[model samples]
Target chain A: MTDATDFAGSSREKWTGFSANQYFICLKGILVREWLRYLSQKERFVSSLVRPLLWLFIFAAGFRQVLGVSIIPPYETYVLYEVYITPGLCGMILLFSGMQSSLSMVYDREMGNMRILLVSPFPRWYLLVSKLLAGVGVSLLQVYAFLAIAWFWDVRAPVAGYFLILPALFFAGLMLGALGMLLSSLVKQLENFAGIMNFVIFPMYFASSALYPLWRVQESSPLLYKICLLNPFTYAVELIRFAFYARIEWTSLVVVLAVTLALLGAAILAYNPARGLTVRKQDMGGSQ
Target chain B: MKLQSRSPETPRTDERAAVAALELASISYNYGQRKALDDVSFSIEPARFTVLLGLNGAGKTTLFSLVSHLFSPRTGRIRVFGQDIDRNSGQALRRLGIVFQARTLDLDLTVRQNLLYHAALHGIGTRVARQRIDELLHAIDLTDRIEEKVRGLSGGQVRRVEIIRALLHRPSLLLLDEATVGLDIKSRATILKDIRALVERDGISVLWATHLIDEVGQADQVLVLDKGKLVADGPVATILSSTGTETINQAFSKLTGITDMNVRGGRP
Candidate 1:
């Protein structure tokens, strides 16, 4: 065996470089751990699917007669209420997942697991991004599960549309997940999670085109329609809605990508140890 | 057995010029208006067992947070070996491992899974990680519990697993903040003995933070922190001799002016 001194020297030299392989392995670690945790909490999986399915079945069923759909860019003919709301429900899954990821972030911080990731040799931004991607990965699974169930309920899209929707869901998931990451940094304690739901989740979901088309909102209240246009969740649903029919909404696509980048950038700054939310929490000895 | 250690590779041609295992110069941190660490400064020599003695709020955890890069100091700098933590955090943190005061293991994950996750975070490949995990579990005598979920393990067993997790990447400096706080006597002794053996056999540098006076050995180097200020830093004998105290307990009491050391360590 090598001398202890010689071994330390060689090992330090070996591990210091930030190679592509190392970054990839780190990401794999985060993803696998997330998947393991997600798999273990079977209730979380069931709930994610259940919430969307309830909206598709019960909520859309009740609204079908009152909310008749007109031909939209993604639709050649008038579609059923359930079919129009399927993508919105997918957006709902992504949105809730983003919030759920935020909740987990708070739990991790309070529980001290966040310390492990923060202290790793990888760059902090990369670690946060990897975590964001992990949440997005889980959201994609939930979205697909919801879509599969929707298909059995007579809400089927084109076969090619199914394949095309993956990228759209992925990008939308990124945007919503980034928003969640930013909210996690802003929320100091786990007890404040209700505030997130009331202030962020509900407002984003309700003011978006997730339930009714923007034109329908424009007819009812032009101000609410303007708010929907401004909501990133609106773009997320529109992007998914367009992709579900094998069409692309370039405006929604651009909005989703740009908002993802902006929110992700903000989340990274908020998590920065020296100047952001973490520093304030540390100032209070992390008690808050 | 292969274990993590440090190389005193920087020759002491001039002692001042040699790279210390860790160096903190005029580091201060604040909690809003309240000061947590008040312009503290100290350094640990490589391959030494250094005890950081402090009462419940002595700012030891705050210092550890700075060293781990969890929170940057409001003023001053921290360096591990020769790498600055703020400017070159990746290189600095790559050489440091920490066992926090709180339990960091994912309770739902098995011991092997938790360690594998940590190993991958440090960029270790799977095969190498598995080999390291096996060797560490064997060394810690927790090999049989490798497949057991962390929640099922005893407190001492969980801590042992955490120690292994910290060592997976073979860090040169290991920091443990109240690592034995809630353990039984036997477990505490066993953990301390194991850590001491690492310093003796593997030549690993350690900064052990504890309020328990009994945990500090007479010959070990010590840093006594008082209310966020570093009050005393030297060998145990040096501190005792300087303060004209007979024991480390008396010396610590004299340095920090805490008369009731017995409260922290029953026999002190």
Candidate 2:
């Protein structure tokens, strides 16, 4: 209710203040809010690292005697199956973590909070992409933790392999992240999502090079080798496999990029408000 | 329908039509062949509080669903501020906010976190959104309970949270679908007062969808949907006069032809 002069100088000051304040807020949003969510979920952090450690410990011990990993291009000397599968195992960790985060979407929807999210004014794509990015960030942390464990086990990659893995991990994470979004939007109920783990994930993982190389699988059965090569999970494991050896595999990169794009497209189609799975009734209020 | 033009000097050109913030024309929806909203047509005028009254099986929720774009009608179109909703859903929806009959909130997060998540999704910047969150907490009387998880909130408090959440975007058109289902009179009055204040102070258009006759009055406009059709539309007193009834309770029964509607019994 003050006069004209009081408003004039304040309006000038407010304009510059808004511009400065907005950039600072956006920075805080991505780093503090998104990154801090992972730090808060202490159990998720622990479990992501634990599942891979179990595989490296007991499963690798049992399989090391039976499985004979022949000469791989990256390995000059004959390495044990234990050393051969570490990269694939790391990829398995990222793959499972991505799908695990995606599977949680149905639970969030059933609990009713997803509705509050969709109704917001932001373009729906940004909201989802940011959430996916946060999931990727979590996957990256778990991947590093797994690598640290491998180093402790006396099975180590080259010093430069870690730097090379950054981009490889990024592509693999995007591909898996996209798959998670696709599964989340398609699955209606939280209970129904168990199929994603058992049907979608396990087959994709087993069919890939995570356990054995494509050449070894081909030696056993050409049909199994073909199945493994066709799997998006194969590219995920192969990409990580090559990355661990500090080598580049162009074919794996192409396959991972293409699958990532395709999955993201499918997820967006399934989530589009018009006829997508999101239109279904979301049961949100309390039972009481 | 009366249109209110804004002053020439202001850049806000879209502020037109004080009489009906949202208008629907011959809108119809179906589940394959079975009609959900049967050739329904209605207009919700601006500033005047309106209540959509109906029975349980009537198309009250269906009508609200179509209006809110949860499910669009297969036939006809919906308009908000003279612009067709489908053609400009982003702009139209950005200008409108809704709270469903069922509460839609994240139970895992704290009330403050939940609101902040919504603000980020709504594209509200961090600083302004933070300030808005504080203001909304004060307005909804949840300032003290901001840090508490939503899983622990009382039913009435949860309901209040949902209402305030809907109003976060400062929508020109606010849709409340069965907002006061099981609340006591005190909670109900607070929500009603908040909505009333929105209309008086912010010029926000509200469509209060409820089956209860006590919620709507003689002065307010009322639309009765019986069996997926727009049964009657006008001021409560005017519409009631056609049935030769004084109170909305008697008028609702007379107009919709419900003779055996007992207070405690199930809806037929």
Candidate 3:
């Protein structure tokens, strides 16, 4: 013990050093809180699932005859449009949940709950990553719920694919959640999330291979195809798609992992107290 | 200037050198082009209620933000109980507890839930946390309200719950930034009384920030901030005598050059 701790007495003993146990406890606390909040707000759960289900049931069904998916690597035979879009719908759940979680973070910031987490004894990066992981956990629940519905609707992958997709969903969710955190750090107000939706969410989703395969987009517009290839969401979707078929797209896996690290790094920097978004005047509880 | 005091009468022991509860040295911070805190520095002694007296935009919240590690100062060092905030932030924050001016409790969660989450963040074991929560709630006379959502509580009750949350980990130094801003007079008094009781019973140092003149007790230490600069620092008696004023309100007016307390500052 340092002289300070000894001099400060027994009350200082508990906080003299950091422990791994405390770290895990903090992580669990964050995850459980997010889970509790997610459960309480049934509307959020329903809305997150509803968006993807709508695209799968209505949009995919309508376009089934029109857009015939060819023999893709993940698909050995000709597949119905709904089956082809299942993984994409899962990605859609992750995408929306990521942004939605970020939206709630902005709301938390506005309402001062973010400050509580920021002021915790843990490192800021640890807190942020835990939050990101918690967001992924919540989004995972939504994705599985959607997958379950799709399965009952006759959009079934191999049983092994169900288990294999867990790791893939985790990575995709992490990458998307990190992207959302990055965007959330930059956003000053909750209302500006609309701008994120119109600018970030829509563009990333539409330009990605989430709805249509990259080859299909290339056949239509090479420029849009280039965009699809460049979009991180595309790799995220492809990663989930391949994993769902008990296959691995090494390129997409590498891309998603790389992007997750990059976005998480940037998000950590953006949330840094020394120089980051938290330094904003409004974040300091307004004028005083 | 008698602006800095280290309880000179107390022996210069190694313990005194190693701790000040909270110490800031030449700290300055800016937001865009405007300065929030400029070369402001002070240290609070252990087991004393030090009032950080500042008006609307006198940078009280900015100072709190720096101390809490919410925003790093552009210049200077901040230490809590002799641990530098930047170099040893975890240690620094470990000993420090803060209640921000803004309401931080999650309105949707029950009081126990909010407090337990904070305990977990501090790494306090669940068993110990439950015991502490029960003790604190009983002390605050809110044991009955533990399960009620924070949204359903009265403003004063919510404030008490937040106070309990801040104290859960047994911090050596407590910082309250305008803690009673929007409460009724009675609630404000009760909260202040409870905090003062903590200082006497628990030997915890407190930095209580507020613009209210009445909050400054006669025996408390005072750090008067004006226009982002610490204008004066000393005991209430010293400040009153130093400024040659009969009362703290008059001394505060003289120090800050604001003759009227009712008038708002230029920044709103």
Evaluated on CA atoms against the true complex, candidate 1 attains a DockQ of: 0.48
lDDT of 2 by residue, B158-224 (tens): 8877776676545667788878888889888777877776666555678988777777862368898
Which residue window of length 10 is worst by lDDT in model 2 chain B?
Answer: B1-10
Better of 2 and 3 by DockQ: 3
RMSD of each: 3.3, 5.9, 4.5
lDDT of 3 by residue, A12-97 (tens): 24444656777887898898889888877999999998899999889999999899799988889988889888888898899999
DockQ of each: 0.48, 0.21, 0.45
- Candidate 2's C-alpha runs over 4 A off are A1-41, A281-288, B1-19, B62-65, B263-266
Report the error of model 3 at residue B77, Å: 0.5
Candidate 2 residue-wise lDDT, A1-288, digit = tens: 012111111111221212333333323343344454566578888888888888888788799999887787677778877778887777887888788778766766776556555554344565566667677887888999888987899877787888788888988998898899888888878888878888888888889888888888898899999999789888877787788678888899999999988998787767665653565533423210
Ranked candidates, highest lDDT first: 1, 3, 2
**Lowest-lDDT window of 10 residues in candidate 3 chain B?**
B1-10
- TM (chain A) per model: 0.93, 0.85, 0.95
